[model samples]
Target: MSADRPELDRCSRCGECRAVCPVFRETRRETDVARGRLLRYRLARDAGRFSAADREAFSRCLLCGRCLEACKAQVDVPALMQIAKTDSGFAAGWPSLLTEKTLADDGRLDAAVRRYRSLSRWLGRATPDDSGLRLRFALPYLDAGRLYPKPPARGYLEQHTGRRASGVQKLAFFAGCGAGRLLTGVGEAVDRVLAELNLTAAIPEQACCGLAAWGIGATDAARRTAIAWVRSFAGEEYDAILSPCASCTAHLQTRLPQILAGTEFAADAARLAAKVEDFFAWLSRQDLCFDLAGLKVGAHVPCHARREVRDGAAFVSFLKKSGAELVKIDERLDAQCCGMGGSFGVLHPELSRRIGLPKVAALRAAGAAVLVTNCTGCLWQLRDLAARFDPALPVRHPVELLDR
Candidate 1:
């Protein structure tokens, strides 16, 4: 396979990203910046002294696609980093104990979610407003009085599409890993909204989208997972693949197609890629209406979402039409990262918190009681941060705020 070295080398070595990079902002080291890492890898190549630490350093990136957005040349930092991770031993580690076990048995995820919902209900703490995986295990540290609505016994598309489903506008609902586990309510809300548009949605049992795998330098595993996922749903007669998670949508729209290129999965991956659409984008194109007049909300567009579909202004526009008084939190020093850049928080918790502090403060000062966004990682990061600093403000999905 040919490498896109020209594009990778497009980094001008400008430390400008250093000032705005959420990771670099916390680390204050050149090595933490995108260019610095690229340069180090280059030097290691020339001198033949590349060490394991160098490989692991690149693995630590959130793959949030922030550096590319900041780059004038728009270098694909995540792709390049993934390649570097592939060369290292990064792919050798089995995913987390939870990830391994969950991926190994799909039923466990649903079971965990169902149990949590039941426990929350029995505790009289369950409401339709709850977010996250309704897990009783996480309730102690994770559930800070946040009540999530019970999932509509069946997903929206399942009701509209019928069990043995077929429709003119068939959609494969890619309930992202977290969607089924942590944010099932959001997934349910997505189905409800799609049903309102008369679209048939199907949730094919699948593996993780391989994003977390890629972010940690498990490139081969990520590619294999993507290929398997695409192949699993390839021949299905579907018009589009719908995803509520911004990361999942972006991966389906970009990574899967790229990795499956030239393979048997290529055509199907491309076909699925073409049909992939963001939930926010789908809602905007629909005829749904909601009365959000009483709510004041702020939006934090994920970096990848901005890269994939651009600043998410169209989504904000739809929210405004739905009657939300939308306010944007401007970042003078850096674009908002909320610090949950996926596994970055797991790998570098202290650094992630340091970088996310500013964004959290911005939300607190926005004077909006609710902060709405499309990314699950953003919600998780911001919610955890809020719990630490100011837990009164609720972070929600824009679709959740919409009237069905």
Candidate 2:
């Protein structure tokens, strides 16, 4: 539970982390791996040095927690590294800051997206090759006409508000900004599944889950977003608050409690954390049935779901009960990130693609026409990776698959 630099002293520097770290796996950079980064942070702390170059080394991480799970020492390198960055007053580069600033504000984010949509419209009409025209700055990511996700004028919160059912069991749905904004259909699919199961879902207005900003060293923006998120669902009466995105669920369940640890919002943060549940995990525990007759569905379990994998068994059990012919791709592939660390793809697209290629290959080899996961980021990454490597593959959420 401690993010202090001293906590990192637990690392024996055994090098087991290198085998598991996604960034290290790709770059083979010691500074990018957990053990190496922890050692670096410790040395910096001992020497009273927090230089910009040192900050970049710490910032160049996936924060994927692969190392934490792999390390026998069980050091929370991600948390420690993040906290160290915050303590040292390290800021993410201007690229991430400018994007985080726009996203940290709802109106600005919406307006920015509208501009991209307008450009997308113009390009789609202009020419077929227009999708790959020009412009590669990667802020809000309008790469030529190929908008990574087709952004709409209004997010899910602006479009839908309040409850959709009345039942003994109630839950608040944290319509994650990733899904609510870019993959709007994912939100619709979530709503459809909740209704189908006769579960009451109270849709609360929410800001960005802050994981994106947190992934970078943008602590101020992340903290502000977290406070706003807590404020939005403060008075809601629900048994649990569910997040359809694995990243959002992870942040809500893990980071929120830590961020508001000693603050006035401690109680509220703890309450939300207690109620927070991964959408698939919560849904899997529900008494619902589906008949996936003559279908071969594979799960591309996101890294957050893996890191918090206590829920994986139940999700598998639930899916088995649904009658779909389940084809688990590979244990390794199922447990890793889909190479989209939110802004990671935008910042280091080639590196992200390289990291995800194995996953793309594994899923393709599974031969399941439809691949399902609980992560919006993974969903987008998988879709992008599949399109690049294997166009025939279809990526979807388990809810969307179940709703079908």
Candidate 3:
């Protein structure tokens, strides 16, 4: 094993990750844990080649960043996994190609979603609550029983582009793909909340945050997407850039600059990164009263919130101040990934389900009236899980509570 990749070499073969890994807990496979994956990467690097099995092993990760949190050595397993995936050409195939193409082009993705919305209306059955449609038959990528949010007829950016509000401070809203496309209600809720605070924000026309592409090792595609995203907001001067999606907030504040480093957009990326703020963090600082007097809320903290934005605690505190009765679950499940690792759920549905089921069950068992998470991906995944467990249970973003 080569020592050049210090991340891989830093692994002390500590099995702490095995105990915390959702995949390993279900599969009980050593290779499914971060330590085992690091060992595999070292051996593959030593041989100067990554086998098909090596590629598969690297792709199995949820990139939830749990192992890094647990590791005393601070080995960056997710970063190493991305490197291994890129080296093995694992992301060059089917789904990655599809994501790279669709997400990198705003017009193309919008057209694709419009077509999906049309098809969904034609072939899918509406749920009783009108939350979304349940497919009657499975498509190539969609499962027959899957429950997905109905995208708005007009996306957030499509409707609100160039729209600005009047306030003392200038703020910009970055509605990532989930809020901009699939769940425009979340974006609307954010606007309503901002108005309530007497704060204003400019809704900019932005593309995907590139976290999905980067997670799948489509580095070039991710870089291009980041450049385009940065260009969209660089022309304006704002006190801060806010994103309701925890994953988008984290990637913008952390990974955007990394991807754009050395490029002409690098300085602009850094400037935007410095101004990026998570919605939960921003909301916590506001001096507004929330009147959720009788709601029982189950909060699922996103991994990015726990590790990057560090707003999970503040969000929980805000929920308490809102007078909502907080449902209790095992503390161990606090920062667990909802298994909606963007492309991970699409590529490995069963594994994603295995990891998410337990967390969802814990919340359900605790008698939560509603489930709330800050990440758009977590909101979607938990809604799907909640629908299967009990359709009456509503999964929502935290800002939605404020909208009420």
Off by over 4 Å in 1: 1-9, 47-49, 93-168, 198-200, 310-313
Q: How accurate is candidate 2 locally (lDDT)?
A: 0.70
Q: Which candidate is the best by TM-score?
A: 3
- Measured with C-alpha atoms, the lDDT of residue 317 in candidate 2 is 59
lDDT for model 1, please. 0.65
Cα RMSD (Å) per model?
A: 4.9, 3.7, 2.3
Native-to-model Cα distance after best TM-score fit, residue 303 in candidate 3, in Å: 0.6
lDDT by candidate, in order shown = 0.65, 0.70, 0.81
As for TM-score, the candidate ahead, 1 or 2, is: 2
lDDT of 1 by residue, 352-390 (tens): 777776776776687677877787777776665665677
Clash count list over all predictions: 10, 0, 0
Residue 345 CA displacement from its true place in model 3, Å: 1.6
As a TM-score, model 3 comes out at 0.93
Model 2 TM: 0.86
Model 2 weakest 10-residue run by lDDT: 125-134
The worst-scoring run of ten residues by lDDT in candidate 3 lies at 1-10
lDDT of residue 232 for candidate 1: 53
Candidate 3 lDDT tens digits, 258-317: 989989999999999988888778778878888888888889988888888746446677
